[model samples]
Target: MSTLDAWTHGEHTHDGTTHPVYRRGTGPGVVVIHEIPGMTPEFLAFADEVVEAGFTVVLPHLFGTPGRPVGAGYVLDTVRRVCVSNEFTKLATGVTTPLAGWLRSLARELHAELGGPGVGALGMCFTGGFALAMMVDTAVVAPVLAQPSAPFPVGPTRSRDVNLSPEDLAVVKERAAGGCQVMGLRYRQDPAVGQRFETLAHELGDAFVRVEFPGRKHSTLTLHRQQEAVDRVLGFLDEKLRA
Candidate 1:
């Protein structure tokens, strides 16, 4: 049986856009947005870790085949689709993806149901910077970005972009100033991450928690599977959501 079979399946809609969402566990709510090439077994496993940690975890299927294993062809196909999807801001600088609105709505719904201080949001790879954008809503208190590779990091301009529009960035800055810390994980030598971490630091100041692993691995929590990174993510969620 597929790992997803254990979770409850549902759909979330916002502004007329709907997406499949898989949920499990029970406690504070956390939304785990999958990376490019869809929700692979490794991604589900990482979500399972969060579920085992005591929080209700929700995995939103953005693209690719569910339960699909990571492969070159799958990755390429998904990348092509996402690049043409208006829901994302692939190569755009200073603009929030339209999909973030739906994610924020999901976070709000989860927070409304769970009724904690707020909900946690984590995005990986192609969707990595999304969590930070979702912070525009107060419901998302704990936002984690894992190897955020947005705007494609093609040139110096896009490479350094944090993937938030001017207006949204202002609000994020306010939230950061108000003590909503944003956590980020990446490899120091990962070219895909570009200079966004530095941009985040400059934008959010100390409110941005930087966790850099050694060497050059793309996915910090999955594929690469760093135990230390996983532990830190869970610890951050626990500290922010459970506390």
Candidate 2:
């Protein structure tokens, strides 16, 4: 049985593009974007935690088979698809992924419906930096980036890139300066995450909350599953959205 069976499913269409969305829980709204290779059981478990924490959680099905467990072959296949997809910007710097616009639209609609200060956006792994990109929109108040690996981290330049265009980065910086805080979590030695956390600290200064765990693990909220990180994320959402 798929864990998603308990959630209400729907489709969100924006600018002629549409994607399946799974929703559950109630209270404030949160858009939880899953990592590469689809929304695995672990990912759904994390979303369940968010839902149980008192927020209405929305999981956007971007790629990969929903409910599929993570495996080497599955990861490779999904990586290939994401690399070829026009919606994602894999090896490029100074540009936000096109899918972020769709995600921002979803956040907007959620905030509009919930009528709170704003909604929260959390992205993990390959889709990690997306939360920061969505933060460009005012609808996203609590933006959490968990092990954001983007631009492929091929070279030194790409390794440090946060996957945001200069224009978008500028707005994010402005928003950060205006009291909007961005939270990030990753393993201290995870090469997949590159130096993006350092870049974030440099770019957003104190507005960027950096959370690092010991050792080398990729997914902070899911696969790696750090309890402290999860608590930090939930606390951040509560502080920014409910408080």
Candidate 3:
């Protein structure tokens, strides 16, 4: 059986949409959104680390097989699904994917049940920018974007867009302006991330704390799994959710 078989699974529903969510640990809440190809072992390991760090980690299975390995076939299947799904903007720029709204609702519900300076959110890869979009709601205070790649990074416009709707972007800007900072991680040479960090810096000003590394390493918490970045993420969570 897969390691995910041991995680407590449930469904989180919002606006008539329900997604499977795997939760573990207790105390402050921290939603850890997975990357492409489903909730792989690497992603689950990262979630376990967050749980060990003393927060209830929620991993929502948005796509792909729940516990499938990362292979070319799995990757292609997930990519195709995301491309056709209305939940994601896929090729669109300057528009928040409709799925982000549901995620925000999930964050709000989690926070309402277990409160401590609000809940934390960490989105990686395809779902990386989702945490930023979820920040439009006050419940998500600790937002972490790990190599956020959405809208496919196909062209210049999509590369620079943060994947947020105009109204949601305005709310994020206002929140950042009001002292709610957002953390981000990316490799300087990772094409998947495009110019997202540059756009974030331009939009969020001093509120965006970026931890950029050299080379083409991707996925700060998994796959590449930089120890320093992982520690930084846990530290950020502690500071935001614990203290």
Candidate 4:
């Protein structure tokens, strides 16, 4: 893989702070939200692949809680602060809220930069619902949610309530009804994501496409499964975004 500097870099003003964002590629825009690892090497490779597939991608540093930059690899400590203390989901939701506005601004700017309609956004496990949240941004035409995990507060009462506020869900639901396809990926074993899909399916009606990677686990659907998880996700994105 080749390392290319983000053509655009700036402070993403969100939640009373300015976080950094890396923008690369030269086609349609794709907002690539990283996993709990921040912008790790693997996630960067995923971003590069999306770029190679002909889409500009933006990687956001959602975990900006001091000393936590992109690719920090502070997973253990992150767990303590985020998961154990439940602050991780809180931090993530804060950024997810402002991200929709940031994407719209980025999309408009990128459209002038790349000369296209707008951008496509991909949110992974820790950030899967983020993509759904950004669907309210008109510039975000194509949205893909991959293994959305966290705050499994979904049931008949809170299914579409993970990370996103109720207002965001209503708007995104409207977009899906108007032809925006929300494609979701998850391993049946990942209960958090499974519950997410269950709730979202109802609010989204028939516009949501949830694909379960059989025998796959919580780890990217690559663990314990012979099938390649990356290939499956890429194919799904290609079908959805590569139009």
Quote each prediction's TM-score: 0.98, 0.98, 0.97, 0.75
List where candidate 1 sits over 4 angstroms from the true fold.
none
- Report residue 65 deviation for candidate 3 (angstroms): 1.2
Any idea how many clashes model 4 has?
Answer: 2
Per-model lDDT: 0.93, 0.94, 0.90, 0.63
- Model 4 residue runs over 4 Å out of place are 1-10, 14-16, 64-73, 80-100, 152-160, 221-243
lDDT of 3 at 2: 34
Candidate 3, pairs of clashing residues: 96-165
**Model 1 lDDT at residue 226:** 92
Instruction: Supply the TM-score for candidate 1.
Output: 0.98
RMSD of 1: 0.9
Greater-lDDT candidate between 2 and 4: 2
**Candidate maximizing lDDT:** 2
Scored by lDDT, model 2 comes in at 0.94
Q: Tell me the tens digit of each residue's lDDT in model 1 across 14-56.
A: 9999999999999999999999898999998899999999999
For candidate 4, lDDT tens digit of each residue in 1-243? 223354466566644555577877765667777766556555666677777877667777665232233433576565455555422443333234444565556555554665544567777766677777777777676677777775444453333445676677778888888888887777777665646677778888789876776654664632232245556656665665556
Lowest summed lDDT across 10 adjacent residues in model 1 is found at 1-10
Instruction: Identify the superior model by lDDT, candidate 3 or candidate 4.
Output: 3
